[model samples]
Target: MSPTNNKKAMCRYAGAQNQNVQRTALPEIIDRIVNSLDDPECFAHIGEEPIHFSTSVREMIEKFRNILFPGYFSDAKIDSVNVSYHMGQEITRLYDILSRQIIHVLRHDCLRYDRECSECERRGNEAAFCVIEQIPVLRQKLAADVRAAYDGDPAAKSHDEIIFSYPGLYAITVHRIANILHQRSIPKLPRIMSELAHSLTGIDIHPGATIGERFVIDHGTGIVIGETSVIGDNVRIYQNVTIGALSLPKDAGEKLRWAKRHPTIEDDVIIYSGATVLGGDTVIGARSVVGGNVWLTRSIPADTKIFMEEPRLIIKNQPKETDSEGN
Candidate 1:
């Protein structure tokens, strides 16, 4: 064979081999392996719900705040002439949206054992409707919360400032909302509300915690008020305060189950920062003060002040005289 013919033949052979290699490897390389048996359900059924609903809840909270405090959070163009009308419209819309979302969450997440009985369903509907009807009362509670914030914070310029720019107010707002749902026994809504606040404010206040009016939480980060914790009126808690539990009830296999664990803070009390008041029986009495960085596990008396004092160290030397008379 001639040199030119041999070179052309070799070049064609190499091109053919490369084309065969690409064809064999491309399908396996780009193909996706989906486990059909693992997730046979749709994405909505298999995957968790989107967390954007929590963001929506936050937005709804902001809207409620704007409704409560006009011109502070909402558009500044609103004035006395049309403020009421605008607020009414906004509140109605918010109520509709919130009701639908809450109902959806309840139907999906909460176990509905009463749905079989007609009477139970009727009562549940009535209770849910009644709680939804209490938005005005919730608004009144929020007003009290704003008052509490203003009263507690020395640097607060006005009620408007507290309403517009306070994390305490935000946490209390979520608590009030969750408290209402909890009282209504609409499951899952309250936790969602509390957790939404937790994500935003770093304050985990269980909805089951019965908090009275005029409760203020100052610098609320790392503050945990557990379920069954009852906080009284005009109570103030600083950051890193934990109303927690000291013990747990274990099952037969020693697995810890949910139990009532937390403290109760009575009226007119002040719990300073980094204080831990634990145990279900630990009751902080009314008009008492708990100092910062104190760990309390016992109940305190009313009108008592508990604080930390520095410990004294003493060293004593035994007398060397009298043991050996001769020496």
Candidate 2:
């Protein structure tokens, strides 16, 4: 087509349509969509607050990080002089946001049973205080994690480098904070905390996982620790490692919800990149090394090394094809 005709064709498609069609069709579409939500399968409720408010949860995590690592991941200026003052302020702010979120989760659970909870506010306060009390312990655990990362990785320069720039450290820190609330059986908020870390770092550690001190995830990404997983001290895991469930029980009752489904890693083990260790019965014993891309489903004794054999590769050059006439 000619340039003039193409421009004319484009101009013909550039204007607004009929007002009556949009005005009539939009409300009808909305009504159809909204009315459809009344079906039994659809889950829109008429009167209820959110199960968990994500904005509040995010704020709680932010303040938690700020407290866990002062002057790192925080907006406030910190020094030895005013450390106590800043810590108090950050904890107060975090408690306010977290308590409200705990209350929201409690109310949501009560809503499912069509009951109004009078104790939600009190319980929320108690839960928040429990987590607040764990801050010092979480810091202690996180310091071990930071030290592990700095000591394990040859590329690490300083403690400040590991604290400020490592994704693994950040995810582990989030998990430590979330694990405290998870252990307290405060519903919904723990998962939210872990998920926020998953969004930022590609590490998917369940809040229910029991991880010990001096843990390091080197160049961490695609690492999944299942809900019932247990990891012992001085363990180091590389990127793309999955310590997950082999199979979930079928037709199991609610009693089996918290049953162990993931593997256990003992102390001083090193899991290299792209390794998958599955099944709750499977254990990596102390001082073991699992090499890259190894798929394991069975337990190994202590002081073992697992690696794949070297595969042979052939080198070949592409042959240029001649034209149809053999030119």
Candidate 3:
């Protein structure tokens, strides 16, 4: 070995050792910070020692994708001979993961509602089974969604490509699975699942939202479907659409907490890019076509087409100026 290289390596080792020695952190300050955090006034979890729900949510989503599209999404090489065995094994694993997570969440919820903690295991099992039992139905609904995408988008070459490549379908598939959990009243996990999809696709559909079959979102980025949004079958929405709340005064408070905040989009409606449909009472009627960049609030009649008038664009060439370097 070269002496120069050995000295360089020795210097790197000495620098690492120096950094470790320099990490003699202030114990007293850390203790004070810990004490401060332990105070109930400072931290909500201070008085409570709950069994926190911890699971591999990313892995859970992957498994969920596998379950939804058996051959396409699973880790294993699926064929007719091994398909049944793989599905059963994967489902069983998913069931266990969901059951554990559900119990953790249900226990916390029971405390909040002053319900019996004893029912956690049973309730969690029921909820998990409820969700699992509906996987076929969910797959059917997702198949409709995939079909919608394939039929609606001219860019899509095939249903297989749509399933494998489309972000909207991925988000919707996750939402469907999470929606089932949300419907069963299992908390936290649903939102977590949806948010995972949101992070992946930049399409935010709250799990609480009621979305029907054959729903499609084309160029789905910047789409926001709020908590109470109700969507019907064969509905197609484009990018930058917000089916969200019309804001209320701050003092409205918990009185209006459970009240619907988002719009009800009926069957066969088409909402285009950059359209903002706000308020619970604001209904985009069945078969209505809302054009791009339209701002709608009130209820529209069925078979109506709402769009903004095209504005004239006046183009003027700017005078060219030289830079400081006289380019």
Candidate 4:
């Protein structure tokens, strides 16, 4: 054979061997990944129907928002003439989504925790019904919150403006809904709802917190209300406020589960920006004013004003510059 033909034949043989190696390596890589799924802590739901987190759960939240604030969200035009009909459709849709998601979470929890089955389907439907029935009451409470926001913040033009534009109000609205499910002892769904709001609003309010009506959160960026915080009616809080537990150990989550690890704010209290009130025993009495940048770990009497002393201001004047022609 010619040298060129011999070289071509050798190249074709080498290429075929490389192709075989590539095909063999692909399955080995896949096998490694598949083997990792056998680990006890991998949490792989192999052969099980997976829970829908992003799609169905988020859509359910949107439906609740549409129902809670009629016409404020992306819903068909709602007016007094056809209000009942529109609400019926919205509630029906919300119930369908809510019940299904609840059942998924409940069933997943039962299987994961090795707990006995408790008729997740029936419980889910009942929970959905209870949440739907609370709509009227929730609306009334939200109205008070809107009114408080308008009355407290001079920048608010109208209730409509707050409903449409305010991130604080939106966060509070979602918290109210999630808190209901949290109170009812539903599994997983409440935290998902609250985390969704936290992601969007930068306001991390745990659904387990008990907040009252006429609550107002102004410039609500960086607000963190812990799980056991008890906020009273007519309370107003500003940005960067932390109503949370003190520092905890690594095992605190297990030890402090169901324990009151946050402060209590009595009615008509105002917590200003950058304030940190820590410890479960800490309480801010009724009508107390917590000034900005103040850190408190103790209980205060009613109508008290807690403020950090004015930061010392030192204004140093700069000497005037001289021209090259020495002025």
Worst 10 residues of 4 by lDDT: 46-55
Writing each residue's lDDT as its tens digit, candidate 4 over 1-327 gives 999999999999999999999998998899999999999887787655477676676788788778878888864777899998988888899999988888888888887777898799999999989998999999999999999999999999999999988989988988999998998899889998888889989999999999999999999999999999999999999999999999999989789897999999999999999999999999999999999999999999999999999999999999999999988
Instruction: Extract clashing residue pairs from model 1.
Output: none
Once superposed on the true structure, which residue ranges of model 3 sit more than 4 Å away at CA?
1-22, 39-41, 44-55, 111-115, 318-327
Judge candidate 1 against the unseen true structure and give its global Cα lDDT, from 0 to 1.
0.78
What are the clashing pairs of model 3?
none
What lDDT does candidate 3 reach at residue 253?
Answer: 65
lDDT of 2 by residue, 147-190 (tens): 88988788999999998889999899889888888888888788
**What are the per-residue Cα lDDT tens digits for candidate 3 across 1-327?**
799999999999999988877676667668888878767676455344364533477777788789998888755698989988999999999999888888878887777657766588998999889988999998899999999999989999999998898999999998998888888878888998888889989999999999999999898999999999999999999999999988888877687778998899999999999999999899989999999999988999999999999999999999899999998
Instruction: For candidate 4, give the lDDT of residue 287.
Output: 99
| Candidate 2 vs 4: which has more lDDT | 4
Q: Give the TM-score of candidate 3.
A: 0.87
TM-score of each: 0.73, 0.89, 0.87, 0.89
Model 2: pairs clashing at backbone N, Cα or C within 3 Å: none
Residue-level lDDT for 180 in candidate 2: 81
Q: Candidate 4 at 203: error in angstroms? A: 0.4
lDDT of each: 0.78, 0.88, 0.88, 0.91
